[model samples]
Target: MTTYQETVAAEATIAEQAWAETFGRAMAAVAGCFARRETRATMAELVAGLLMEVDTRNCWTLGQALGHPGPHRLQHLLSRARFDHERAREEIARLVAGELAGQEVVLVADETGDAKSSTDCVGAGPQYSGALGGVGLCQVAVHLAAVTATMKVIVDRALYLPADWAADEERREVAGVPEEVVFATKPQQALSMVTGVLASGLDARWFAGDEVYCGRELRRGIRALGLGYTVGIAATYQVTDGAGHRWEARKLINKVRPEQWLRRRTGHGAKGTREYDWAWLEVRPDDTPGGNGNGNGNGNAAGAGAGAGTSVLVARRHRYTGEVSYFRCWAPGDVPLGTLVEVICRRWRIEETFQLAKGFTGLDQGQVTCWNSWMRWSLFSLIAAAVLALTAAAVHDGSERQPRLVPLTCPELIRLLRAIVLSPPARDRDHVLHWTAWRRHHQAVATACHQQRHRRHDQP
Candidate 1:
């Protein structure tokens, strides 16, 4: 008998308590990261501000949100505070595992670029911004997220310093870059994060990523660690057919018979099921153990397929268009195709996490210019994002009674947090209603404009 909005409101009220509990527990986990009690208290306020909507996510604005008399304390907490950010990340890994425990937790690795116009920001240099889809001046960081069917949270991150910046002694000293911090490629950064995750005993079943991490050594290393992986590889990657003949991935996929490709729902999209034509071919087994994923050996050996390792080439074809993509995977010989597809699709969850964190919690909106500050701000941002995600998961689990109602999203949860934090008096209901109507109108116009842009593209 209750209306959808009323139910949502009730759920939001319930989720607030969950958020507070989550935040408190998370703060406790990260308490040891700060050397001083004052620093920990200030970090709690900053994280609370980040969880709520704010005009800006800098120290000045955050201090105002926490009703601080001045911004000096908050500024010191980030820029000059003595805390072990790396240890905080380790704590986060454990906390995340506790929050979203599952049998088959997935670790997704990716890098995101944060645009920085000022060169003074630590690790800020002209680098390829993946967000921009082209080369642009930005600061890039390699991040790893723990993802499950219900939620996703970034548990590890490392800033990427260009070789030039690493080599610049003056710049390094001025920006507070550590003496031990050297230039590492994105893949290497990912490997370090993966190693950290494994060391933390996070129970990750699979490691997934794009071509940036599909190098031969990386794949070998992941296998050596006894972790399964499905990573993107180039179309030109070489493999062997059943007859032991070498072929490029694209050519091999093209040779896949029509009957071999099956239309399967890879995963769920925003609207509904995402179905695609998928086909897979097992690589010729290597006579030697731990061979690179490429299949260069003859397939006629009697016990070759029963060896210790298995490699495979999996291809996905667009349902609408025949456009195909390739991935090279190394796993146990008997792993199912559906399991491979699910792991491959989990790589996109990190992108979704990035969007949610950046849009609502200012994941890339900090103004710090020191190494310590950058690390601390990122740690707090991840905590805020995890709180939001865990709370949303709780709300979603409780909203099953109303079939017509939709589950809560990250943005909606963030808005609810803002409303709870900034609850106005009942006398101001008319004013709040007026602004709410205006916001809905603005959203409608924006949605129509977005749709029109797509329509124009379709027309052309």
Candidate 2:
């Protein structure tokens, strides 16, 4: 059999092919904290585990790459993955910001709820899962993110609403919920995440999200910070037009502003005439979109960052393809209404990240139940997937016309990494010495990764 190494070299090799070098540096930065002794696993091995395992358990198998086996050292390196997330996010932001140095950037908020059996897990509760209706125990994390057409987005995130049981001293012991953790509203978490990104030195403006974070309180909070925002609002959320104006879509008589009052067909019974009121309004410093400090969007017209005496606001709307419902949009009067629309649309892309994280990076496949093991698996899995995504963006996504600010995606990146790691005649190469290059190259030369796709989930 022809060896992998020889086959790779025989094919047309690109110069610098520096992606491997870049990956190593990024892994080092991201995995710095997870370092144990020299005996512990390396970043490369952990990533391979993430990619191979359908779930988090692959983190345990990471030791296989280094010739280490069972009792997989899952705890030792997951800690390091935390640093990796921060670094990766920062790098992504920096790379993107550099690409659009003088252009506008959009921030979007969203959450994905995962249903689980345990109430002891952080934020676990009897919450509704859109994916699985009928109120199952679930957890949701709201991600506050920045996006641009040109670059990949990195969510500057904060995990949402910890389990109520986790905070209860009496239930703590039974459910394994940690004490330091506390219950938080998803919107509050979203704010913490956005501010966290700003603290990291990202000069971003313009934010958008679904109705979840577009509540009056959250919108008010964003405006108070002097940032521009656009978010979905409930149609029942009555807002007086311009200044102290107030009126609900149901009550307002006079105009077919359904264009202004954009509507989308929503809900289970939503059939026949389905549409939503997609409207935009301008809020003054003394005013808010949804009165009582409870609005979620910036209004119809998106505004910019506020200055002395001049307050800012946001605006925009979306009704989705299905579901008959009317969602209101809010933004300050001064912001560009057109740009707000662009920002709100950016949230759709983040879903792709989640999909890749699961199908490609093993976000949902971890089998570890140990406390230390859980944290390790969670952190490393995210990092590995992110690295793969960014790398692929750097190489394969060569569309010079589109915005190149965002990095490549996970699947594309992993293909390249594995190709190098398991390099060979990826394509178009003469057949010779199947074992020649592969055999000559010591197994130890290329880092051995965790046993992922190679394993069968037969263990009871």
Candidate 3:
């Protein structure tokens, strides 16, 4: 019922078609991401699957979009997606260093696991669960992208999760290692990608990530690389003060900045509504007495914690109205605290990518196999997503005294959706669905949702 409109806007040339062009450009840019060309399907078939329809055969096109090529495209573009994302990230880093983009933006890192049925996938196994429904053999990967000026998402890293099931030599053989790909910890796989992106000779002011990647080694790696970082760390994991007195990040926030703890700010209230106080200090992690997360060697937590490193830590005070809350940031001590804070906040932009890719661009709907086709399919969806956003941005060019950085509204979203669905040769139904009618449909949906909530006694 709900849809994206500006994504479907009209254009004279496919080249001039801003949304379509954006998708095309992204695909072209990521074209060489693969080392071998895959025959999954042609690029056209990939794009068509999303635009028109998808069947079993055409699904390979979507794989190409994702960075996989069937034996067909593998010869041309068949490598991991990390390389492409890294290249794009390097571009963003270059822009940042050249002062073309803001350094105060967030560099969010997150990993999403994909459930797969095939045990033969080069990298797939049952591991820690992240999805809501259940757990199965799945691949986990972390993506790093920069978010600034309320636009732009450059994914720099894509690390595949390698489960222990594939760790043993026999298991590796059965799972089929090509000899080039070695056994690596999930964190290591992710770190390699992160390091590569940074090694791309690009500079970023900060980095942020979820807990899976917030391990001590990862933090230490970032710090060693001289970068700032923020993460949604476990509340139970503690941080020690210069005096060697340790307290959980959550406990410290509660003890040091109680008022802001358990703050409940969401959506619109997130921006401008809350600001943070910044502080920097030395940090050392110790495993809690037992079974915490530090893996036993360290005394911070149980199974996982940053091992033996005195790193720079930042404490941020988040204030909601009159109450003040707290959070600590960890990074290479040399970097400024402000830079770390800026980068940590940028992680929010990735949420937009997920929304657009799945909800707006229709990337999540694919049910195909083979690495190549999957890659193409994903790429097409990604390109389409970027194009829609860019076109919507291009639509507004006014020099207002106070310009709205967030361009495009729900109306624009719907407009883009309608554009693709409504083609040439207007039908009788098209005449019935004029601007007025469209607006009414939009209002009706919103109103109906509200009424439904009211009926359920959960009206907002």
lDDT of 1 by residue, 1-460 (tens): 5577788878977888888777788899989888899889878877777865566677755655565545688778777878888898888788877766655888888999888887778888887888978887788898999888777888889999989888989989998888888988888888788888888878887899998998767766676677878889889977766677888899888777999998888777878999999998866533233544345545322121545545678999998988899998767556777888888888888999999878767789888888888888888898888878878887777665367765788887777877885332222455445545655786799999999999999994
Per-residue lDDT of model 2, residues 1-460, tens digit only: 2454433343213212545655566555544443343423455655655555222345323333233433234444543223334455555445444444555666677776667677556556787765556677775556554566644454454445555554577655543435665777878777777776666556676667777876666766776655766566554656544445566543432333544554433312225543333434433332343444432334432124432222323222335642332334434444444444455556666676667766766655554433334444555555565455445544543433223233334554455455556332212232223333443453435333224423444444
The number of residue pairs in model 1 that clash at the backbone is 0
- Of 1 and 2, the candidate ahead on TM-score is 1
What's the lDDT for all of these models?
A: 0.78, 0.50, 0.49
Segments in model 2 whose C-alpha atoms lie over 4 Å from true places: 1-18, 31-41, 53-57, 60-67, 79-103, 161-163, 170-180, 243-245, 249-333, 368-376, 396-410, 422-460
Q: Residue 327 of model 2: what lDDT?
A: 32
Rank by lDDT, highest first.
Answer: 1, 2, 3
Worst 10 residues of 2 by lDDT: 423-432
lDDT of 3 by residue, 1-460 (tens): 1122222222222223544544455555545643434422344334433543222223333343333323234323323323353344344344333332333445566666667677555456776555524567765545556566545454443436364544556645654444566666656665675676565544565667766666767665665666656765665766765455776665554444444223322225444554555544455443222224333233432111334322444445445344322334654324444455556556666866765566545554554333443444455565555545455444443212123234454234435444553222222444434534645776799999989888889644
Clashing residue pairs in candidate 1 are none
Report the alpha-carbon TM-score of model 1 versus the true structure: 0.86
Q: Give the winner by TM-score.
A: 1
Candidate 3, position 315, lDDT: 48
* Model number with the top lDDT: 1
